[model samples]
Target: MSYKDGYKWRQKSKQGFKTKREAKEYGHVIVKELDKTALLTKDTELKDLTFKEFADMFLEIKKGHVTHNTLTMYRHAVDAYSSINNIKLSNIKPLHIQNVVNKMVSSPTTINSYYKVVSRIFYIAINPYKIISDNPCTGVRLPRVERKNMIHTISDEDLNKFAKYMREKYPQAYYFLQIARYTGMRLSEVYGLTWNDIDLKNRKISVNKQLQYVKGVITFEKTKTANSVRILPIPPILEKILIEYQTHELEFEYDLVLNPYKKNGVKCQINTYLKQFGENLSAHNLRHTYATKLLANGLDVKTVSALLGDTPAMVMKTYLHYSDEMKAAASNAVANIFS
Candidate 1:
């Protein structure tokens, strides 16, 4: 370990750590010890801060800035590091963080969430807190995440069956499903819609906000991103259905198009129908079906992204394989045109 002693670089040597990671951690310890007095604040000691203590401070600072959902995630992250709660900030090593990561038996996606939270805490400890110089979470190995073959979508025959079932059995759910299918709106966004958002005369639908479950209550919240707030052109089929459904609209306190009380049940029933078709699909599958069809039918990524209220980069990434198939079709068409 090396440090500057009043302008001249000085070196301190140590030995006997089992592995290179352990040796690297020991080196950080040495540097902290050598400059302990300088690192300490007037009101706080550099070596006295525990992981739990720092995490508490981090959460307290985060509470006001982040959403309720994000704060909940941060809390889960703090709980995930309970094993190392008592360990001093300066004493935590890559091995300690790695052990905690390995102990988590959850899915890779969930584990990554916890890892990100722990990493942020260590990052804060290194910066403004100055309690530690190195972030131990950097070298921790997380479980590998397996990517899916493709995003799931409903086949045309299955889609026709689904539409027929919804229309016959649950007229309200049928209308909701049609809007989701045609516009590719999220479940929350579809639930958030009101008659005011729909312009049957103009054939337009404005997506302004979304409904979220906050503190056990369904409340209005901003869209997932700024770009998520957009306007979509309503197709003729959807417009025809909306016109008929409008005649049967009932009075509701929230002025929502779909019944909030029965929407959950409707979604559950839709999911049940999909499961019977031999796959676990949900309302979001309607969205996937829409995007995949549009891409297959020659819509550009940028235009589809704008319609879906997502970035073109995100659209391409999600459907790159499908896009390649579309490219092959286009190539065959171009060759046959001259032939």
Candidate 2:
């Protein structure tokens, strides 16, 4: 390994690492011998390659870290930020990326997605590639995204109306919506349900795995978060639905709640139903709806978070949008205390 001015350490001297710890140890030694001050900073090799070239290498390295869907999204960010495609990974500054982001008039959420992916690209360009010393993405800022948190959730009344409509209009896949509405499961998690995962005798549901469609094949992925793998009581409504649903013949995956439909197919059907009724809903909205209802009804953030497969902090940040009545109740509580 050699440490040049811009290229901090080039492990090209050694073909590859035999073990993770050994490689990391060798890297730590290089850091001490070279900069000896701060952690891995951007280095000069960045100037040598175009962003496209760097991306090819960066994405290859990324394959081991991210999921296929995540990698697909990274690819999309590359495509969306067309202006940065030809820039040199090293010469590219934060301002250049910030300018490109400024021009892409889109939702804050969309802008954030683009910004994060680009940031990772620059991060790759920095340490391992040693192409640039400073991560340009660090100095860059995307437009602020406003969370329409309260309006985003479907009210309990609306959920009931929609669930009833779905049950009558689309019987086979109806429970999927009900599960998402009541339990706050992701579309994939809803699809992942097998009869084996449910315990009607005990009125409990175990959410340990998620079913997703990756590359057109039905895949079983681990739940998004460790918090996501929870056991929740079967709500009275869900209990009634599941008991009826249990009678359906799910020959292949006998225990799955949604045996008849794939993930996308279920989504398409739900969206179609929503369109028919002029309802604007998403799969995540159902989860959010469930979470919001729980929080709005005085359930603690921690409990709601577990049910929704998210952190309590995350639940408070994203789910708790109190209604006018709830806000008034808060005011009344303070007034009563003061009086």
Candidate 3:
């Protein structure tokens, strides 16, 4: 028998009933008991929903709290998963998830990110929505990822060569490189710099924001963090360069000090100008050059860390190879005493 409350019910005993009304009442009591039991049991609750519906709900709720860059990554992962296997929520199994993961040919880090997003969705469904009994991704193992260092530090000799090349080929870009080397600022931060941010009297530049091209439009946003917003002292040579550059900018009536050429008052594409010099280096290489030079000059890790807006540990980890050479030189200098 069935009840109007959308539950199936049945009589336990085969004893004959006195009337149809008595049978209907017995069916209602059985259905109420079953409904209570369903709430208590895990298996019954998990069988109610589809995986696709749960994922959609989770993403919709998460969209408001996350940044646009984070949302883009989440959307990419979810869309990729949905496109490959159109599995329903109730029918999804551990093996199905494993299969979908195996088919992905991306790097270990990327695959792990995909798994993380999916795992979070399942976690929300289980606790908050009460749609699933448990998270399916509980014990799934991810691939090990070895961190690869890809930064190339510009050497002093090479830096001089690059400067000369820039001077000869692109005079304006040469000054941009000079500021980047002295300030240890990121590419976006350098591009976003304005004349007002520079304190000629104090010989410092206040880094507060970054300029980026988003969706083919120029947008200015806050620096990555409170620590990232800093004031860096300008080297004397760079200060002279800036003074001359500022005068030039005023003569041309350009808003930005770095790249005077602009489209609708926005900074021009620096990378496009950089390419004319050569393929040996880029604008970002200037930052690496700054950090490496600091390490080479026997500067303490903490000081370099602060200047570069990184933690001391990160500075040690990334520049330790250079430090090792310094250690060897010091050891050699004291070898006569041991000998």
Tens digits of lDDT, candidate 2, 110-204: 88997888788877666565556678888677788787645466656766777787778776557788887777787777778888888888988
State TM-scores per candidate. Answer: 0.79, 0.75, 0.64
Q: Identify the superior model by TM-score, candidate 1 or candidate 3.
A: 1
Worst 10 residues of 3 by lDDT: 260-269
- Candidate 2 minimal-lDDT segment of 10 residues: 36-45
The whole-model C-alpha lDDT of candidate 3 against the native structure comes to: 0.69
Clashing pairs in 1: none
For model 2, the local distance difference test gives 0.72
Best candidate according to TM-score: 1
List lDDT for all candidates, in order. Answer: 0.84, 0.72, 0.69
